[model samples]
Target: MDGTIINSIASAERIWGDWARRQGLDVEKFMPTMHGARGIDTIRNLNLPGVDPAAESALIEKAEIADVDGVVPISGAIDFLASLPPERWAIVTSSPIALAKARLAAAGIPFPRFIVTAEDVKVGKPNPQCYILGAERLGVSPSECLVFEDVPAGIKAGEAAGADIMVITATHGHPVETPHSTISNYDGLHAHISDDGKLSVVRG
Candidate 1:
């Protein structure tokens, strides 16, 4: 739901920056690593000195909730999603249910019938579990699905699940060295997902 469905990175950075300031850490140093990661996972992976676990968890939750303010739809995301038949697509995000719903609603995007959130998976992105589960819930084989992702970890997950993955460069700066195809936005993604489930990109 983050950089893909909604561009919440700026809000996330601001919230995390405030948390880092209160903890006497350099916000700039930590924010990069925090991007595209689950809130709790970001805290655990920090490996920072003198960081309190409970306080960190509370702060992260607060930041996540605070970020609800500036959520905006990514360019062409809504149109792309709406153009597809509901049965052919699903959302596999690292966000929990409430946040996902809030962001989607705020962006005025139609919620997918099948969604696999961070809370629903044993492992998050780069693990393939969430994408795999989303395909299962949608009753579609992984090979028949096309995934739109904005981060390397999510790209890895979808590709590992045998889906045709398309990386959006809005998040994570530029595309990483993943094998999946990359696009600047979702503008022409609909034509790419054809009737037989074969994927193609028509560049203009």
Candidate 2:
């Protein structure tokens, strides 16, 4: 959600950079992997000695929730999301529910009826389970889902879940290498549902 529909890189990096420094880690090496992942899962993966992943993640979430100063919706994201059927589109985000809501509000995006947030999943991105569950809960097969993602792990997750993907490059600091379709934003795109109820997103 952050990278795909919302651009919160400045706020995110500020908070995460602080966390990295606190852990005496290199920010450049540490920051990239943090995007498109649950904060707790990211912290847990670090295996930092004497660190409580849950607590550390909670702290980070609090900071992010409170720091939405530069958070803004990607160009055309708001209108694009509004154009889609609420039940047909779900936000499969790695952020905790509170933080997700906060960020969405900051970006002026409404809450979708169904959101597969970090709390709803047993595992996070790159695991396929999150996206798979999202598809299942939305009453669609994974192959019927079209995921918009901005990070490699998320793209891999969508691929593993048998879903098509569109890479959003709006917030990328450097070129993202992906074979999947790419879009800088939701501009010039339109969402359509056929008579049979199959959703199709097309570039206008």
TM-score of each: 0.83, 0.97
Candidate 1 lDDT, 20-125, residue by residue in tens: 7887777778777666656666676667687765467666665576567777888788877776667767888877677678777877887888888868977677
Kindly list the per-residue Cα lDDT of model 2 for residues 1-204, writing each as its tens digit. Answer: 989999999999999999999999989999998999999989999999999999999999999999998999999998898889888989999999999999999999999888888998888989999899889888999998999999988999999999999999999878988898899999878788899977888778
Residue 165 lDDT in candidate 1: 79
Report the number of the highest-lDDT candidate. Answer: 2
- Which residues of candidate 2, in runs, are more than 4 Å off? none
Which parts of model 1 are misplaced by more than 4 Å? 48-55, 172-178, 191-204
Q: On a 0 to 100 scale, what is the lDDT of residue 134 in model 1? A: 91
Per-candidate Cα lDDT values, in order, are: 0.74, 0.92
Give the distance in Å from residue 28's predicted Cα in candidate 1 to where it truly belongs.
Answer: 2.2
